[model samples]
Target chain A: MGTALKEKQEKDLQHEDLLHRYRNFSARRVLFIILGVLILFVLAAFSLTLGPADVTIAEAVNTLLGMPPSGTVDRIIWNIRVPRVLTAIVAGAGLAVTGAAMQSILRNPLGSPYTLGISQSAAFGAAFAVIILGAGTTQSTASDAVIFNNPYIISISAFIFSLITTGIILLFVRYKNASPATMLLTGVALGSLFTAGYTAMQYFASDVQLASIVFWTFGDVARASLWPEVVIMTLAVLLAFAYFFYKSWDYEVMDSGDESAKSLGVDVNRLRLHGMLLSSLVTALIISFVGIIGFVGLVVPHIVRRIIGGNERYLIPSSCIVGAILLLASDTVARTIISPIVLPVGILTSFLGAPLFIFLVIKGRDFW
Target chain B: MKLEIAGMDFAYDRKLVLKNVNLKVKEGEFLTIIGPNASGKTTLLKCINNILKPKKGTIKVDGNDINHIGMDGVARKIGYVPQMSNRAFPTTVFDTVLMGRRPHGNWKPSDSDYRLVSEYMEKLDLQDIALREIGELSGGQRQKVMIARALVQEPDILLLDEPTSSLDLKHQLEVMEMVDKQTENGLTVVMTMHDLNLALRFSEKIIMLRQGKIFAYGGAEVLDPVNIEKVFGVKVSMAHGSCGPVIVPESCVI
Candidate 1:
């Protein structure tokens, strides 16, 4: 009876120990989440305050909250800064989340929108839309002249091609039993091919058209308008994020390989296909609006993975938040660093992202 | 539940891996398929689990044909544990085991699923490492965790491919012993083992394969020195031990 009681007491202690560990883990994740959300909010406000025409923080806040503000302050904050900042947040989050999902699905750390050639494909499509479709005088001078002039259509075209290229790559990988290295090489080849095509189109383009394409590809949040393109991209990204969150566990299991996932009753092929498709969709949506921003998708997921373990539940959401903050910070730097002439958000991100990625690689030499 | 594979033939491209392989595993039987490398042991196992679609065959679980049932249904009834543990991401033992409940689970794991996982983990002596990352564990512990994951499926039939290949002697014995215990509890086990002695000791019946064909299929008593030498092309002697016959290679003798 004494031994039985001792055993029961030991069991209770073990149970308590498990509970404590679980609570601690959950607390850490929740704290990070809260911290991430708070940081994003702070960054958003900072973004609103930091432009060429500096509106006071109070006026910016008032304009944001839709109060009756001074016309100049209202116009500067509402018309100029708000949309750009929101674009950065949305595009950053979307690209990062998409990258996280792609990396997990492909089981390749190097997997991302740009790494998989999705961005390049989008660029090709955008180039086609601008150089080929927009070049026709009839369409260029029509009532929808502004539509042809807008970069959004080109972005959408690029997005569709990116999705197509991604689909083709997946099919090839599946059919040929290609290694991850092979898939990476294939993506690079496709990306380079599309880039070549885009360059040729640029060579033939009018000065204004070439400049527009260049600006679009280089990425400028300042060019982002509070238009239907922004709204659609935002909705698509949010929906994708929600769907990924719902299926995060399935995505985690899928990283274990097809046979293992299948034995565990996950439709491995379907899961992978769905994940890739959704990721590409989100990538296309964002790249369509903001052109191709690099590194956030590539680096954000890796950073989140290091902090929280590779459970997609934590990884996806954290990546979204981190991506948003990183882009906002980078965009701020781009605005301030050169003063009057703003550096492309893409260039700034790559500049910051590449160095940080190299640091991470150096630090995480032993990490899998 | 009984598993029946009738006239199963499998091929990769045009090269046949299995030809007219008919196998019937009775309920609660511990069946081990022993074969040399490239003898189709793994292929046969894959066909049984429906991972590789057999060119010409029908697999039936209990009374229902697998073709009629969905892959998910087949998976619910059959659990597979591969030879190696290749995890791209660092998954915890608890989460890995919880994945076995995927077929029965919604998006989120339920209370009963957690309970079942815990029970299986406890049974496999994996409770200590339940929260630990799978990559941190040793080969044997990872294997046990894999087994626990399979168990959480509540499968009637467990299929293991070279389950003990990477394990040390102690772990190999421990894992096989667990398999032995599982059989007594009415869990049907089908496995492929490279070690003949381990197969002799643990399996209720052994099915020996050579070049995609069954060389012999019977009790351990029939797997004598002459047969072992003939099948494996190695000289060996079988001596009666306390519990069973012990196979000793000729090189072991002074």
Candidate 2:
């Protein structure tokens, strides 16, 4: 009896020892996250000075610090350049983090923001709005809505359609088989379906409506922001990131497969559904504003995973910073490379992203 | 810490997998459930762990019906390691094991979670490869990593399905030894094993399952030639080995 009592006491002490062990995490991970933040700020600052109006870093900072505007330079920096940069950063981050979550939720590496027809649906909505509203109304509503020509109507239309598109996917999740493959296939079918609808709508668009539709599809950050309008998405994506970060460990457990995760006490179905809705919402918000920027959502998550491990707590923020910096850099190049002839940032991303991704894959050699 | 099941029925898409199954597993008991393919061994384990909801049944841990306590609560008491997981994409071994602490935490891992994970990793001889991706590890190493992840749950009962199915002979024995050690402590283990000999050797109790029902269950005595023939439709003779009972299959008489 005495021996058994002592043995049990020793076991309890061992359990107590585990609880008492002081906790500290790796310093290297912290350094990388801090480094990513610094790189984003540096890249954004460098990008701000590189556009058609060559505002120097000092001028940009002075204009930012609320000093008296140096006439056109201040106006250009504050109005055109600043909003464009902020929009690019927020939209890029939203796309990448949401893409990461979507891939995990679907349990498919190929899953992305565009996977569920979100971009096509948003485009269809924008085009549909242009065809209907422009023919019916005068030119006054166009400028009033558009950033330059017809902005607000197209965005609002895109936003509404994108939500509807995500709604379709969620409906499939609830009623039909909610498997990852089913979702991916459904997304592909929806993408084709929406593209066909947009093409049909385009046939009836007038000259002015057609041009606006074409411009929206080019996916430029220049068209998105005026002043504080971009704040909505920035705040929304931040809230989404915080929510996912709070449940980051659950995502990690989910990587082992649904059954294993369920046995670990995770509600696998609910979390996957939650993740899909959230990812769709994030993508829809960006697509409505930025017009279907491709590859950032799909590419940035993998790049972040390559640098950092597959932990969402770090991966989500890191992907955000990396996506922002890369898109900002891409946007900077798109505007500056031809001096006055600005290229769409979307074209530049594919041009730069593919070769670099191929190089990483080849150099990775043993990591498969 | 004891697992008890009564009048359990399970079906996938209304195709019954396990029917009218009743079982009781004691604390610190090593119970090996053996059955042929689709015979419902895996389903039984899943039902106990709440991975699958029974059609009509009461599964209790320490006399508490598991359905009432909820899955997260069941998770604190039961940990399950799947038979195969090649579908899982790459993540570091440490991160993979740390995921077991999810039931106990939501945001960040507690100090105790880390310490328990470290201890299990050390016990499983996985400290050397903790930073390596699970995809990079060999089959045997990955199995150990999975077991380490299951152990971090600090579960009173551990359930495994075909854990050593793909492992080599030496690796299989090594993996079994690690699981057997869990029973020496206060943890109860219920595992579905492919090798009848491994089951007979390691398990204190063996349950023979056939057609979604308990054909027979108990100690090594219940695992005799006649019962084995009835359950598996094979001719087998049992002999005393240096360690435990050894089963030799003479013919597939079915």
Candidate 3:
């Protein structure tokens, strides 16, 4: 009896310790999210002042805080930098949240808008607009920017083709009863087909058309105008984010497996369909305006997952913050790396994201 | 919950998986389904949990048809732990177990949900590794996590598929004893297992299935050499062990 009492006391103490540690882990996740938001704020401020206009961080912040536009500095801060940074933040958050959702719904760590061919389809659509419909032309300006004949046509066509690819994949999932792995493979196959179409379009293009198509393929957040494009993306991204956040528990249950998720009262097929449609819609919207910013969707969620584990309540929000930070920082570097000759932020993200992803895979094999 | 299945049939495409299965389990009864490979033990459990829709059947819980209860209603009554697989993500053990409260609550878990999860984690001896990733645990630890997840659901009926398949002797005994205690509290347990001895020790009622059909169903005496040979195609003799009676496989009946 004495031994039993002693054993019970020991077990109670152990339980207390376990509870403390669990709380600490939860606290740590919250801390990471807080820190991420702070970093995003600081980075956004720094990014606003780092362009060719020589505006200081204070000046940019002042302009953002309702300072009257008195000179070139205020105009550049309000017009160019604000729209670009806001676009990056919204677009980045959308890609990351959708990436996290895609991974959960598909039960594949490699699942993302980019990996599932939404970006490629968008690219194909843009190519069709530029090469076939003559929607873009190369303006022989000092900046060598490709001016769209009707930018809305390019964006609309890109959006349409992306939906078409998503439609084909959903059809396969519905009729063929395709598994997540099978769906990914289908995405890869369709991605290749679309790439072939894009290449064929390029082969038959005029020099100006080819230049315009190539330039449009280079994803740049600065391409978005503030009036409708940025406003539309912001609303779409926030709506999708809210939906994903609300369905956070369901996504966490889905990580267990489809059969297990069903047993837990999740309608696995419906969630998958909804998740894919919303994620693809948001991806198409972002890509249509800013072109194919590849790696934010794929890599940011993974980095956040490694830190916070696979709990979607924390993972989704953390991925959003980290996604915003990564894209914003990449955009800043793309514009400032060789001043007056801004590289495409999409090219820079892939350049940075590829190596970082490889390193994470090598170093954290147990993360998945 | 009292469960009744009548005229149950399940098929994958044209290939039949379960054929005209019928069963009635009383509330708080400890039932074990024993069978060979492809014997539909797992399928029957899935059907009961409403994870798979049967081609033709009516499953009732407390005389109410499960089909009419809706998925969430069924999940509130039945908790399932599937067979352990290699597919795992980096979810913490505590968070994984807390997911069992999904049907009971809304989006966020309530405080009582956390309390229940903590209680089950302590009972399962998983509190020590509560913060560890599920993927990082050994097979036995992962199995315990799975069991704890199911137990935290607070369901009237618990379904387990090969719960002890990966556990060692000590863990096997511990899990069985824990589950046996739950049965005393009026939790109905329906488990499919390959281990005949463990089933005999803990199961008050035994179901022997062979090729998608019930070969035998009764008390411990029903698991005799004749029934075992017919269902499992193995010749076995019941012998006394230090703890209880054990089935010693003598030779292959084929």
Candidate 4:
């Protein structure tokens, strides 16, 4: 009778333990999600407040809320600063989420937009548009002369090339049964090849064309107008995010290796191809608009993994929000740190992202 | 469900791995295949799950040719576990097990799926470490988690390739015992094992392979001392123990 009572008590304890765990897990996830959304709002507000013509946080809020604004502040807040800030936030979130998805799919921490040669290929394509297509030159007259002044054409070219590069890499890796190390090496080689082509274009470019190419590569959110480019990029990012979120479970399974995922009823090849395409599409859209922002893709996913573990359900969304905040903060610093002279946000990201990545590496060395 | 393979011939490029192999597994039977290294044990297991298509011959599960069924449909009927454990990403134990329900439902796990996963975790005594990262677990714990994941699939057929290769002796017996118990539930289990004695002790039937062809297929009675010596190229003596007959390799006397 004593043994039966002991067993009953143990069963009750186990039941309570499970209940506690389920409640705690759900609660913690909810808390993080709320925190993430709140951080995005705060960062958005901060971004709106910074720029060449500084508006006070209060005025910016009133302008955003469609209240009466004082003097030139309305134009500065509405026309220029708002679009730039929104561009930074959207592009940052999209790129970081893409990076996270890529890393999870490839099962490599180093996998990213730039590391996988997608961004570099896009940059090369843009450079090709500028040089070969003469899109950078300002034309004055002559009906027969080709005019490549539109940024959309260049962006489309970049997107196409980036997709092609990713497809080629996937085909080669699948055929060769290449190890992750070899995949990374191949990506690096492809990146270098594209970079070389871009450099050659730069060498042949005129002074004005060179300046334009350099600025594009340095990444500027300022070029984002309220045009079709913004609309298209926004739509593309949203679609990519939706697709990735839907496949988050598959991505999580994939991190366990291909064989395991296959046995668990995941079509490993289809999952991988879909993930790569989504990631490449997101990366291409961001790079086309903002040019080559280097380290956000490499660093943000690692940070998100450390914070919430590598479950894609949490990782994808968390990385998106944290990435938006980090880039917004970096952009704000870039604009305000030197007052009138704004440094490129990409440069600032590298300066900040590198140290943060190193810190995470040191802290999470045991897990790695 | 019964699995039948008829005149199966498979090869990588021109080098044949399995040639004209025929086998049948009844429902609720524990079948183990034992062979020397490079005897195509892993390859045969891969073919059963349609991971590698047989160059010649057909495989059927429950009278339906596997090729006629879609890959996902075939996967739903069979659960496979490979020999190696190399998870590059640090996913948690619960999520790993939850993945087995992939073929059963949509992308998001339903409540029933979670319940099934929890049941398996508890059965495997893995509830304590369900929240932990898979990488942090010991070899035995990791193997248990993999087995738990496969169990969550609720597959009619479970195929394992050297499932106990990395496990310690105790964990090996623990795993085999679990597999043995599952047989009573009318689930067919096919496994490739490296340990001859364990295979003999636990499996209801054993298939011995040499050069990708079946050398022998029968109960422990057919696995005589002469046959063991011939297949493994090692001298062994059989003794009747308390539980059953034990094959002790002569080299172990030292």
Scored by DockQ, the top model is 3
Q: After TM-score superposition, what is the CA distance of residue A109 in candidate 1 from its true location, in Å?
A: 0.9
Which segments of candidate 4 are over 4 A away from where they belong? A1-16, A70-74, A137-150, A170-185, A225-227, A364-366, B251-254
* Model 1 misplacement above 4 A: A1-9, A133-148, A170-183, A202-212, A354-366, B251-254
lDDT of 1 by residue, A212-298 (tens): 566567766655557565677789889889988998878887877778887766777677667777888788777866777888898
lDDT of 2 by residue, B1-254 (tens): 39888899999987988888988888999999998888999889888888888999889999998888877899989988898875445677878888888888867888777777877776787766877788888888988888888899899999999999989999999999989998989899999988999888889999999999899989978888999888888989988889977999999875
Q: What TM-score would you give candidate 3 relative to the actual structure?
A: 0.96
In CAPRI terms, model 3 is classed as medium
Q: Can you give the DockQ of every candidate in the order shown?
A: 0.54, 0.49, 0.64, 0.56
Q: Which structure among the candidates has the greatest TM-score?
A: 3
Q: For model 1, name the residue pairs that clash.
A: A122-A158
Q: Which pairs of residues clash in candidate 3, taking residues 3 or more apart in a chain or in different chains?
A: none
Chain B TM-score, candidates in order:
0.95, 0.96, 0.96, 0.96
Please identify model 2 stretches exceeding 4 Å from their true place: A1-26, A68-74, A135-148, A204-208, A365-367
Q: Which rank order by DockQ, best down to worst?
A: 3, 4, 1, 2
What are the per-residue Cα lDDT tens digits for candidate 2 across A1-368?
99999987875665445333312234455677899889888888787788656678878888888873578887888788889899989888888888888888888778886788888999998887778765223342432233334667778889898888789889888888569888888898998899999998778777667766776777888777766567887887897788777777788778778888898888988898888888898788888878878999898877766666677777878888878877888888888887577788899988887777777666642344
lDDT of residue A273 for candidate 2: 83
Q: What is the lDDT of residue A259 in candidate 4?
A: 74
DockQ of candidate 3? 0.64
Give interface RMSD for all predictions.
1.8, 3.5, 1.6, 1.7
lDDT string, candidate 4, A5-69, tens digits: 99878966775575468557756766776898898787778778776566777888998888737
TM-score, model 4 to reference? 0.92
Q: Order the candidate numbers by TM-score, best to worst.
A: 3, 2, 4, 1
